[model samples]
Target: MPMRLTKLLGIELPITQAPMAGVQGHALTVAVSNAGGLGSLPCAMLSADALRNELTAISRQ
Candidate 1:
């Protein structure tokens, strides 16, 4: 059967990285994305400017 999760998430693999607040940042998210898995960014603890910066960094990768 086709991998439904991969199809739904638009990722090459079915793997998904859980958002790790304080332990992970945009770099890790980008790395997982580049590796063809679904990566998560934890924004619950971030300020608006910090979130914007993280997004910008992720977009640059």
Candidate 2:
């Protein structure tokens, strides 16, 4: 069956990587995005520069 969340999110799959404050990093987020899932990156505890770098990395992935 097709997942509505996938359609809504415009992803191939409905999977969403949790935004684990310390655990979710750029690599894991990019990997999940590469696999056609929603990759969530937590920015609450990140420095502005770090978040920018992570965003830049994820955008390239």
Candidate 3:
């Protein structure tokens, strides 16, 4: 069966990695996304430049 959340998010799986503010990063988010899940990038603690870089990294993954 197709996963509902996956369809909702346009991801390959229903899993969603938590946007753990201090612990999650670009590499981890990419890994989760690559594994067919929604990888969340938390921006609450990041500087503008850091968020931009992380977004770029995620896009490249």
Give the residue spans of candidate 2 off by over 4 A.
none
lDDT of 2 by residue, 1-61 (tens): 3577788898998788998998778999888888999889999999999999999988887
Q: Mind giving the per-residue lDDT tens digits that candidate 1 earns over 1-61?
A: 3498788889998888999999999999999999999989999999999999999999999
The number of residue pairs in model 3 that clash at the backbone is 0
lDDT of 3 at 13: 81
Provide the RMSD of all predictions against the true structure, rounded to 1 decimal: 1.2, 1.6, 1.8
Give lDDT tens digits, candidate 3, residues 11-31: 998788999998879888888
lDDT of 2 at 32: 89
Q: Candidate 3: list runs displaced more than 4 Å.
A: none
**At residue 23, what lDDT does model 2 achieve?**
75
| Model 3 residue 10 CA deviation in Å | 1.4
Candidate 1 shows a clash count of 0
Error of 1 at 17 (Å): 0.2
lDDT sort, best first: 1, 2, 3
- For all candidates in order, the CA lDDT equals 0.94, 0.89, 0.86
List the lowest-lDDT window of 10 residues for candidate 1: 1-10
